[model samples]
Target: MANETMLQAFEWYLPADGHHWRRLQEEIPIFQKLGLTKVWLPPAFKGTGPNDVGYGVYDLFDLGEFDQNGTVLTKYGSKEDYLSLIQSLKEAGIMPLADVVLNHKASGDSKESFSVLRMDPANRQSPLSEPFEIEAWTAFTFPGRRDTYNDFKWHWYHFTGVDYDAKHDESGIYLILGDNKGWADQERIDNENGNFDYLMYDDLDFKHPEVVSHLKDWAKWFLDTSQAAGFRLDAVKHIDSEFMAEFIRYIRSDINPDFYVFGEYWKNDAAMTQDYLEQIDQSFSLVDVVLHMNFYDAGQKGSQFNLSAVLDGSLMQASPDLAVTFVDNHDSQRGQALESTVEEWFKPLAYALILLRQQGLPCIFYGDYYGISGDFAQQDFRELLDKLTFLRQHYVYGEQNDYFDHPNCIAWTCLGNEEHPDGLAVLLSNGDKGWKKINMGTLNQGKVFIDYLGNSTDEVTIGQDGWAEFPVEAGSVSAWVDRDSLVN
Candidate 1:
């Protein structure tokens, strides 16, 4: 029953590391109480250094030291803490899914310092261990050099700051100048040679065979331990497509056959993200730039953050069965970007649409489950999660359904059983305020039940009209219908 709903808690249940073993011990019962079946912890493995975010892999074997200072000071904690957390989660029937970074690793700031040095692609000993001298290589040229993610574009524009020999490809790395002169092209680095090509983070060269092997080995170890359900692959698009495909295949062939793997492809449209999903058991469903822009405009640009008909339909077109849907994620929200932080009252509505919709595995962000930072202004988010999970089990997860959408609104209904005479319906309003009358094609009489904010269940008689009017609160949502109230 717990596995059916499959509630995955993001990050470790307690503060990561061994210090909170007792807290983890307490978490087992609490998670079970909350109907959660999985705990998705950030990479429990060893990180590069204090500043490393676990993705900057230093050693897969170093699980970290768990003293209080570990969580407070360093990104990783002690090995004992990780093992304990895994054990506890497993024993409580909650699977642990760790985030794995296979594409890149931590290296010395300078090309000379990196152990896996040498940019000559032919001379590289191991793709996984080898580092590149990216600082000297040319950075990606945007607009003109766009869409060359899989290939290399040396004509990058870094603001008129201290340029790194742009014309001199002798160093093997180039800079992509940006408006910020000093910070131009810092994120784009060489896959080999560890060139600081890109800004902020280091990018790895996935073309190397050694990098491929490292990813396979990581999958093997996790499956061998029988602790994790699968993995949430990070920065997948940055790596080669072939590498990702083979990695997914190896995990399935060598590890648990049913192991689940999802990638953070990060593109904004379903069309772009679809091919990546073909490589994994499941993936973030949609990644269209246009769709994301709409969300941005609606949510941030003095407009409502409502799902658009065009964007929703386009995403559904990608892969109805395998897409994992979400309202927002870590990268979606940034300074001056659309505020991904959702309104309290509107959360349930957004979730209700995804869970009740016909396509994609609905994924709820952490704050959506539990109100973050004591901003308990309104709504019981945790309780809403309980209801949402219950609905997923009874309706969304596996049921076949139909979708009806519009520019300002979207709604879906899934039939449970032929004899039931009732069904579950989920609806969302992207508009500011209005009452949308939906004619569900009049059917047999039954009470209509709506649980929008879970604040109250408004019941209306079907009558001969065979139609129900859904009142969508401004910037909010509602999920109800006469159909499957029996299950909840």
Candidate 2:
């Protein structure tokens, strides 16, 4: 089977001109040429406003289809434009994964009176104040939608918590006071920021049968209407784990078994992500946040960082098959909330590590591939990204060998499989210029390998023992391949 690669088709600072869907459609041929097997489009829903980045979700059912939320189309485009993008991706043999934001709902239709207990932001498990009555925007009737697809109306009782109190003109984590409304079981989510269940706006109560039923029904409707091949679940850590596991199962068994789901667990600790993986029963893959942090650490440390331990304690190292590895993402952008950057000089090395490796499926960021807006646009990695993807699609297959013993340098090789006789070798250095003797196996014996990256002009010939020393520039990456063995 061919390798699977994903492209995050949008960025945080994309133009809010309601042309993203159309722009993405225009890039289908480029995506195919770059060997992208899947594309994770931004959330197709209506958020707090037309320009909202889709995280401040206002309506799960409003996928730029309804006239609500002060606009008929989302930041991307109209519902018709979104469906057309999906169809175009399918026709191009690329899978479309919709961004699913189920953690909370924002900008309700109306405010309603409700009893609540204020909780400490530091310790969500501890109540800070006695029961008090407050008004909140918990009533979501979606007036513009008006009983079109599903007539499910959301009420205060359908949620567990809210962040603002219209009555008191204050903002705090207010736990809903009712028969069975509370934060999810403390054991079911991350312990950060106390309970971690109340992440903003109106937090949905997954324990509520009606709430559960409505969300599930909405997902089915979304899948059917959008014709997307899978979903990229946002903020899985804040959502109830039991409900998430069930949600993954429902969509796969009920709609399509081949349906893929990539989750954003957003935990820098591999063990914490692993805990969620076990909770979900390994039903889907997760974006490897731990690995992203690893890249950040190495970039900051430079030669001082141990290249041998670059992959250590990362989700990609622990669970490669279930890991969706990436170098940077929307949240990690310069000014984003979760801002953590891998130094610009080290980005090429980072891409090579993820794209050239065989363990985990890789995802390329739009900002890096197509360039971001504003001053950041000048920071381009397009040329290197294109070259790496080309190498990944053509070579970098079959039996793999690792040479990660050095503290400042590491390398690997791929012995060609029967069909693809042009396997490649990759070497990266965090310190000074380095070279390593890698074994390419007897199949590659006597083959003359040259650096595909053009960083080195040396054409090293493999001896009868199938071993040759490949060189890499200081603080850079290089890929080597048998130029004569190429099919073209």
Candidate 3:
């Protein structure tokens, strides 16, 4: 199969207008031509209010079809518009992956009295207060759509914990009192802050059988309703690993055997990410946070960073098949909580490292492609990103040969195969303008090449030994292709 790329279709700062779905419908053809095979659409369900970006999930069943959350339509649009958008993507031969927020639920219907114990904010396992009765916002009765797709009403028993205590008028990690309740199998979770299970806003308890069954049932309804090919799970590290694996199994077994799912196992430690993958038997792909951190650190250090060790401890190195690699996303974009924007100068280099190489499946951020709005408005990298995707579609194939001998310069070539003969040569530098002699294979020994990235002006002919010197501008990346292919 050809290399596939997924584009995150929404940014953090997209306007709260109910026309995002329409906007994407029109833009699908443009990105499709640029080789976008998959799209990660933002959560389509209704949230706290009209402006809620779908992360603060109110009702999974009320997918902008019910008159709730102060508006009938979500930030994206109404249910009809969402269904239309999915159809448009399928018509264009692109797989749509819907974002699923199952870790927590927000904007409950009302507060209900529940027993709880306050745990230390830093250490989730350590109890800070004794068991006491507190009024918590853990009741979720979707009054708008009382018994539409699902009549399931959530109570305090459905969740393992709540953040706000309506009784004490305080906010803390209040572990819900239950027959058998605690952080869901701490060993399978990330061992940060003793236990990093509870994130925020009524953490759902997957151990509860009712909660588990409801979620599984909802998955079926969602897929059947939207016709999405897969899901982009939110906050999987905080959720139970065992349940996650089981949930994925149930989906593939009962729903779609080829249902593709990836999770936001948002950790920069590759080993930890792999361990989580192991607990789930490598069931799905995960965001390559380790690799994204590497890009951020390299951009921060510039020439001081080691270009060769870029993929050292990344999911791309450990498990390329299960790595959904990306440079930045909604949370990582500027002004967000996890903002660690890669420098503009290093953006091209970072993209080349992911998009050109035959490793992990590359994901392009919507912010980078369509320019961010609001307080952090910026220019887009549309032209260059489009070209890189074009290369991946037409020229990037075969075996890649690495030339990571230099500290400030690195280059690699994809020796052409029977299918894609005119392979690609990618060279990048973090410091001064550099040149590296890379062998293009004896098959193209006499072919002349030009820098497809427009970073270098000179053309060079490959020697009889199939070696050609490729030039890259300082602090930039250049992609070289056959001059004949460039013309035709």
Better of 2 and 3 by lDDT: 3
Tens-place lDDT digits, model 3, residues 1-488: 67899999999889999999999999988978878889999999999999999899999988789999789999999999999999999999999999999999998999999888999988888999889999988888888997888889999989998899888899888988879888888887877878888998989998899999999899999999899999999989898899999999999999999999999999888778878888999999999999999999999999999897888899988899999999999999999888999988889999999999888989999999999877898779999998999899888898988999888999988876788889689998999999998889888889999988898999989999988888999998999999898767
Candidate 3: where are CA atoms >4 Å away? none
Which candidate's TM-score is highest? Answer: 3
Alpha-carbon lDDT, every model? 0.48, 0.90, 0.91
TM-score of each: 0.67, 0.98, 0.99
Model 2 Cα lDDT, one tens digit per residue, 167-192: 98999999998988899988898889
Ordering by lDDT: 3, 2, 1
The model with the greater TM-score, 1 or 3, is: 3
- Candidate 1 lDDT by residue in tens digits, 74-177: 35445656677777787777777777776544432222111123233332222332433334322322222133222222222211111133233333222222
True-structure RMSD, every candidate: 10.5, 1.2, 0.9
Candidate 2 local Cα displacement, residue 87, angstroms = 0.5
Q: Over 4 Å off in model 1, which ranges?
A: 1-8, 11-25, 28-38, 50-52, 65-77, 91-93, 107-203, 275-294, 301-317, 333-346, 374-380, 395-406, 418-422, 436-444, 448-458, 482-488
lDDT of 1: 0.48
